[model samples]
Structures are given as C-alpha cells and as structure tokens.
Target: MASGAIAAGLPAHELAYRELKQRILYGEFKPGRPVTLQGIADELGVGLTPIRESVRRLIAERALEFHGNRRISLPQMTHARLEEIYTVRSKLEPELACRAAAHITKADIDHLEAIDGELDRAIAFGDVGAYLKHNFRFHRALYAPANSQVLLPIVESLWLQFGPSLRVVCGRYGTSGLSDQHKEIIKALRAANIGAVREAILRDIAQGCTFITDELFANENQP
Candidate 1:
C-alpha cells in the first residue's frame, strides 16, 4: 500500500481497537453487555484479527472480561473498584485543583468561564451529552496548570470508569443548577485561595460519591 493509503487506512486491528475502546469508555457499550470479536469486526467493517487484538488490550486494562471461548463483556463496576478510584481522586484531584488555582492565568480562567456558560446552557436544554463533555473540559482546564503529565493518565483512567456512572446519575437527577459549583471554583481560583479551591473541588467530588454510593446501596436492597 502507498504510504498515504497506509496512513489513512491504518491497520485494521488498531482501528478496531480504538473504535471498540472508545465505545466502551463512552458507555455506548454498557456494563455486562456481551462484546464479541466477530460482532465488533462486523460492526466496524474490519476483520477478526484486529478485533481480537482490541479485545485483548481492553481485557488487560480491566475494561473488558473474557470467558473461555472468546466471549467478552464490558466490565461491571464493583464497590471495591469505586472506592479505590475515589480514594485516588480524593488524594490527587484536590491537590491538582489547588495547584491550578495558584498557577492558572487569566486566560485560562476566562476559558473556563466560557465553558461554564456552555454547561449552564446544556443544563437548561437538558443536553446530557453536552453537559458531560463541557463538564469534563471544565475540570480538565482546572487541572491544566498542574503540568503533571504522568498523573493525568491515571486521572483519565478513573474518569473512564466513572463517566458512565455519572451519566446514569445525571439522567436520574436532572443536572440543572449544577454550574453553581463551577462558579464557586472560579471564585476560589480568582482569589488564588488554594485552600478554598481544594475545598470546593473536594465538595464537588464528594457530592458525586454520595450519589453513586446511594445508588449502589439502593440497588443492593432491591432483592
């Protein structure tokens, strides 16, 4: 194949892997849903080899489960996994938020404010996808000042797991008025009050934890 075709086409396996991973992470493939290599290959118009490679990677990442005969399912969230992810976030995200508050520039703050406005619109329109996307960008912008490249991947992994649950929670409880926390965070950042910024972020994350925990417990009692 010519270099351009090679570049454009990409290896089928890599394409399959990326497409499958994105779907899973984005909650398009819900928890416990069966995902077969052949099914994925057919869906993506690829061959089995690439789909197999994709499945292997997801399994390694604990994002997918594989049974004896190549049967696979999206990984289900456990209380233990949630606790572990939350613990990591509790330690890292607040510190990052504090660092961001100290180092963020006016431009960064302005960008975040714009995103906050977008989030408010999403909430008003009940656009869950838009809300989630901009909400993620708002948090990412806050953490941008930290410059911790190594830590970002770990944080992003936690997000991949938590994102679906968050969607569910947002669906259950309408997201209107959620931009209040963003405003508080911006206020803390503007004042360069690292403590206030950290507290605000912690409170934001804690509220999410409370919701998820409540849902988990409620589900458990549904026998």
Candidate 2:
C-alpha cells in the first residue's frame, strides 16, 4: 500500500489507478514508453497485485495501451485518430462552452482567469508539465459550470486520448512556440456573448489541431 495522505482511505488498487492516470495525464510517462507492473509497484510502494489491476483498468479505458509481454504504455497519437478527436471536440466542446456561457457566474470566470494565469506562467517558464496540467484545469473549470453529466465525461475521455500527444507537441515545439486562444475564450465569456464563446472554443480546438497535425507531419518526414 502506498503511504500518502491522499491514499489513506482509498483502496490500494484505486489509489494506484488514480496515481497512474495522473502520471499519464501530466506527461510524466511519455507515449510508447514501456511500463512494467513490477516497476510501477516499486515506484508506488505497493504490491504488484494492486498495480496490475490498476493498469488493467487503464488499458480498458484506452488511456494506456497493452503491448503484450506484460508491458503497458501510453498510446501514441496518429494523424487519423487525432483528426477524429478534433472533429468531435470541435462540435461538442463548443456546445458545452456555449451552454456554460449562459450559466457562468463572476466567481467561475474569476477562477478560470486564475487558472489561465497559472497556465501562462507555466508557458513562460517552458514548464511542459505545469502547462499541460493547468491547461486542462482551465478548460475543466470553464465547462464544469455547465453542470452537464453526459457531455463532461465524453469530453474528458477525448482529453485522455490526446493528452499524451499534446505533451509530445509541447516538448518538440517548446512553450514559447505554443499558441492559445484561451484569452479569446475569456473575453467572450466576460461579454456574455454565447456565439462568441462558441466561436472561441472552436478556434481553440482548431489551433490545437494545427499544432498536433504539424507535429505528425514532421515526424512522418523524419528519416
């Protein structure tokens, strides 16, 4: 069992799952890097049983890929797969943001702004980990106010799929080269313009798509 305040009451397997998922989300484990059950058990200070179960669940979630030989790794992004993800997000996410615009309170906007500030600082320092973490936080904070059970999980699943790839892009491009339309999102939200908010979300998605697509192209052209 892992000895930590957050894992105190949680079951060993659940704790392992949460920790593993977070590691993947934060790009601590790069895409296609093999992770062994024993290695994870040692790292988390838990037995292999719990770590194995946790890894199995992540595999089922498509967040981690099982490469036979008892090896597990984060999934690599492909051009086709990323295109599908962006297409879905380009539609669903903007709708979510539009809905959120109607119900957003000043406090919610304040929290989002704070998250953006953190995200900006992370970019300035070229901190890929902090940038990815805070970028997710900002979007989640924005969408949570919509209070939709169905859409939130769907959007999160998409994030789980592409997040590792985003980290790869950040590593390749450097934070200074990254682009974000989140400020446009904030401006639209503040103005209470639902159409503009939706457009901003679409633009954000488009920018991300362009970044990932460019990375994919560069990788393909490499000898």
Candidate 3:
C-alpha cells in the first residue's frame, strides 16, 4: 500500500496532500508559521484548489492549525498532547518492536545499522532535517520486518502528526545532547531477545519524550 494517500502521479488532490504532508512531516513547515494556500501551491508547483483541500484534511488530523485570520500553520506542541502521544506510543511501539525482534533477519539489522550511521552523520553535522528524516527511516525500518498489517497505518498516522513537533524538539536539544537508543535496539535484536527489544524501544520513546517535555516546559516558563 501507499505510505499515504499522496504520491507522485496521483490525482491532483492526493498529490497535493501527500507532497504537503511530506513537507510538514519533514519539518519544512515551522510551527506557528502561517502557510497560505497559494504559497504552498507555488512551492509544490501545484494549484490552490488542491492545496486548499489538503490543508483542510491536515487541519482535521490536527497536524495543521487554522487560525483566526484564516491562516494555516503547523500546530505547536502542548504538554497534554505530548503526554498523550507518548502514552499511546509507549503502548504500541514497544509491542511492534517486540514483534520485530522475533522476525528480524541479519539483513534487517545491517539496514538498521546503515540508517543509524546516517542518523549519526546528520546529528554530527547539525542537520536537523536529515536527522529527523533518518530517524523516521530507522524506526520504519525496524518495524517493517514485523509485517504488521494492523498496526502500521495507526503507527504511521501517529508519526505524521508527531513529526513536525519532533523537529522542533531536535532543535532545542542538539545531537550531542541526545541519547542514541538505536544501538541498544540493534543489540537486543541481534540477541533475539523480545523482552529486551521491547524495553529498549520503551527507553527510546521515553528518552525522546524527556527531551520534548523538558523543552516544552522550559518554553512555557519563559517571559
């Protein structure tokens, strides 16, 4: 199945939605930065009709916010929402990782290693965009081996909504300040320890939540 409703050569509406969604997912759209339909149309080389439709869909998903002036922007993170997201992820992702551990092959581990290496390079260069992209790729790689027909779509929607805010979090805490849990995940996978893999994934999610929640609180307290 398509990763999302949008892809190249899809009908105009879907094409627009997917391209716009990908940009939002990659943090190309900064939180609270107003995005006009025409502006997105210009950026994506499409028309305003498709942009308008896609923006509406994104708003319904809570991925984009429609403001008083009719401006649309990425939603800023809140403690409650962040907590809720982490809570769901804590429950779901570890389960998926555990399943992945059972089914993972040597090639899967090697692919994960390669992705993590790229992630490290992104962090080293302070390439926040690349870091976020590769981090998504790493998780997707880890879970794909599980062949989850049921959980994949739900997990993907969650990732789509969470992606932009994650970029902001990465900015607040640079690569040096971040913990690398993919290493532990890889080790547990190699050992074929399902429990260990689950724990490792839980730790990974919690570690990221810490960074984001800390930053959110810090910003909340600012004058």
Candidate 4:
C-alpha cells in the first residue's frame, strides 16, 4: 500500500472512486447499463472492498441503483428528472457565473480562453469524449472563483446526473453545432457585463437540456 503510487497521493479507495466516477461522468457507461463489481474490480485492478465502497457512495449519491446479484446501473433520465435538473441548472449556473464575474481575474480569464481553444478543437475533431470533458472543465474553471462552498457542489451533483445522458445525446446527434456559449461567456466576462454572462449561461443550459429531451424523450410530454 504505497501512498501516491496510483494517483497523486490519493488512497486506494479514493482512487477507485475516481476511476468509477470518471467512467460514469464521461459517458463510458451508458445509461441504464448494469455492471458487476467483480468486472470493475478486474478492470481497475483494485480489490472488491474499494469498489464496493465506491459503489456505496454512488448509490448514496443516487447516481447508481443497486440490485441483487452484485449488479448496479446508471439510471435512465425521466422527464420529471430532466426538467428538475434543468430548472436548477438554469437558475444556479447563471448565479455562479454572475458571482464568478465579480471575482474572476485576468489570469483566470486567460486560462479559460485556453480551455475554450481546446473545446473548439474537440468540436472540430468531432470527439464527443473530448468535447464533454473540456466543456465540463471550462465551466468548472469559470465557476471556481465564485468561491462557493455550498452552490458549487449542488451544481456538480446535477451535472453528474446529467453528464452521461449528454454523452448519449452527443453520440446520437454528433457535435456539429453544440453552441459556442463559451465564446460569448468569455466576451461577456471581458466586458464585465454580468447580465450577459448570466444570459449566456442560461442559454447554454437550455440548449443542453433541450438536446437531451429531444433525443431521449421526444414523446415525453405528449398525450
């Protein structure tokens, strides 16, 4: 049990948690797909104890549902779930950006621009994984300076629930026109226009929620 051997000083159980969380967050695990503890243990080369602990945490987070026979699955999105997550995201993400506008420094803005460049490259290459990865990174970085102890975790929880389905959407539709709100967000940040930043984030949230619904729940609200 060498400390930092696996990933920058994280304990074995923590590393196991991250390995599993990344698979779910980045869309490697499809929605509603069940997986086995033994299989994950084999893949990650960790013991079942850590994997089971990680699964317990995910289950507690409501990101995974546990069943008998040593299986767990990422839940599929329901319309009610979609709208609620959207409602929270639309409201809170804007507030985060607005708060961030007050605190984001020049260096932070420069770093965000660099991440946006990577985002553009991901889109151009039609790499869904990269696009999702960088997209989340850009927003996380933008919101980091808000220094929110409470709101940030809530928002990230919302993302963990929605992120995998978004991967499914991107794969089905392709990343041809994923909205360049990051560009607008950067411009607004430069102008110091908090309102513009809020609006851009709201539009980004709406567009993303719409994509998931249109693709997965087209008949969702129909009679």
Choose the strongest candidate by lDDT: 4
> Residue 214 deviation, candidate 3, in Å?
1.1
What is candidate 4's lDDT per residue for 1-223, written digit by digit as tens? Answer: 3244344777777888877777788888888888899998888887889889989988877778898799988888898999999998998999999999999999999999999999899989999999999988999999999999999988887888999999998999889968758889999999999999999999889988988888889976789
> For residues 195-222, could you state the per-residue lDDT of candidate 1 as single tens digits?
8888888888877777777775567757
Candidate 3 C-alpha lDDT tens digits along 25-44: 88888888886777777877
Best by TM-score: 4
For model 1, the run of ten residues with the poorest summed lDDT: 1-10
TM-score-superior candidate, 1 or 4: 4
- Model 2 — TM-score against the truth? 0.91
Ranking by lDDT: 4, 2, 3, 1
Off by over 4 Å in 2: 5-8, 219-223
Q: Give the poorly placed runs of model 3, Cα more than 4 Å off.
A: 1-9, 68-70, 219-223
lDDT of 2 by residue, 54-132 (tens): 9888887788888787788888878788889999999899989988889999999989999999999999999999999
**How close is every model to the real structure, measured as TM-score?**
0.80, 0.91, 0.87, 0.93
TM-score of 1: 0.80
Q: State each model's CA lDDT, in order.
A: 0.76, 0.86, 0.82, 0.88
> Comparing 1 and 2 by TM-score, which wins?
2
- For model 3 the TM-score comes to 0.87
Error of 3 at 223 (Å): 9.9
Query: Between 1 and 2, whose lDDT is larger?
Result: 2
lDDT winner between 2 and 4, please give it.
4
Candidate 1 stretches with Cα past 4 Å from truth are 1-22, 45-54, 172-180, 219-223
